[model samples]
Target: MLAYILRRCFYAIFVLYGVATIVFFISRLTGDPVSIMLPPEATVEQVEQLRRALGLDKPLIEQYGIFLANLAQLNLGDSLRYGEPALRLIGERLPATMQLAGTALVLSLLISVPAGIISALKRGTLSESGITVFVLIGQSIPVFWLGIVLIMLFAVHWTIFPTGGIGTWQHLVLPAVALAFNMIALVTRLLRSSLIEQMGSDYVRTARAKGLLPRSVVGKHAVRNSLLPVITVVGLEIGSLLGGSVVTETVFAWPGVGQLLIQAINYRDFPLVQAIIILLAGVFVIVNLIVDVLYAVLDPRIQYK
Candidate 1:
């Protein structure tokens, strides 16, 4: 297990480095940072000075070396537009994003796991059929549209919750629901299938023959065995929810990394943009690492390999 973990850690490091290298070069290759950062009427000497100051005058390799060195020290450089430290800006906005994503993940799990189990248990019933339709609709709907519809109903018409902002619990409802909807559908489907398979297994029948109650047979035995797939889906979805908040945050004006990324892009703020991408990638890597560790706890027989 330890060897497997070490191998995965090594793989994660390489993946991060690869992602960083891609992000670094792609940002540079796509456009002229100096042109975007400078004024239209700038003199030749002024442009040259700016290039030297930002190290654009150096060879690509040297600039990358500087970036890697600074990154090792956690110095993500300054925001092109804000003139602030990239890490500081990310730190300021990270908590709100974490709060939003965390709440949405909890809501998704609470809603999905039970719905899945009940639907599986009642597989052919009218209620179960209805739930299937619900899941289909949830999966089909786009999150941005959902956010808009939610705002129209709850915020504009009902005026119960604020349409946008990060002020209070009321402000969190629409965005969280929007973010959680797709995850809920996906998790429900995954869990439902897993539960059905577990129920049909020979061990489940054996447990029942031993005179265990149906609930205990399903809950204690079937559910745990069924959880491995659900765990994988949930972990991936949670990471995506945290990092893919760009559109939802934009629509709702939520103060998260996604929104920050948008602002950085519009201004061609390369440092901030690069930092945001790296930070998000790091978050994703960390979440998956934790999920990998969880597999050991979920099933002892499952080795890391």
Candidate 2:
């Protein structure tokens, strides 16, 4: 297990480096930050001075080398727009993004797990059909549209929650629900199918033949075995939610990393953009590694070299 963990950690370094390289090069292609940062009436000499200050006057290869050196020293450099350290800016927004994503994940699991188990156990019944239809609709709707409709209904019409921004728990409700709706559908459908398959397995039949209660057979035996795939999906979705919250955060004006990322992109803030991308990519890699380790924990039969 230790060896396997070490291997995964080593691979994660390569993945993060690749992500950083791609983001860095692509951001440069979006056009010079000097053009975006400077006023239209600024003099050519002013532009030259700003360019020199930003290191854009240097060759692309040299800039990339400097970027690598800074990364090696755990420095993300100063934001071109904010004139603050990029990592510091990201750190300020990280907690809000984490809170939003964590809330959404918990809400999704709470809604999906029991619903999926019930739907699977009661297959071909009215409840199962209803849940299937709900899942289909939930998955089909786009998150941005869902967020808008939610705002209209709950925030504008009902006035039950704030329209946007982060403050009280009420402010979190709409954004969390909007972020979680699709994840809930995905987890529910996957869990339901997996549990249904597990219900027919030899182990399930053996447990039943041993005179175990139906609930015990389904809950203890089948559910545990079905959880491996569900856990994988959940872990991956959690990572996705962190980065994918861009649209939801924008719609709701939530003060989170996703919102900050949009601002950075709009201003062509290369340092900030690169820092956000690298951080999110690292988060995704770490989450997947945790999921891999959890496989052994969830299923004792799964052995790691």
Cand. 1 TM to true fold: 0.95
Tens-digit per-residue lDDT, 1-305, candidate 1: 78877887789878878888898987776676678778899899989998898777999999899999988888899987788999899999999898889889999999999999999999899979988998999999998999999999999999989989999899898899999999999999889999999999999999999999998998889999899888888778877897658888998999998899999887767789889888877777777877888888988987766
Instruction: Output the number of the lDDT-best candidate.
Output: 2
lDDT of each: 0.88, 0.93
lDDT minimum window of 10 residues, candidate 1: 28-37
Model number with the top TM-score:
2
Misplaced by over 4 Å in model 1 are none
Q: Distance (Å) between predicted and true CA of 56, model 1?
A: 2.0
Clashing pairs in 2: none
Cα lDDT for residue 140, candidate 2? 98
Please write out the lDDT profile of model 2 over residues 207-272, one tens digit for every residue: 999999999998899999899999999988988899769899999999899999999999999999
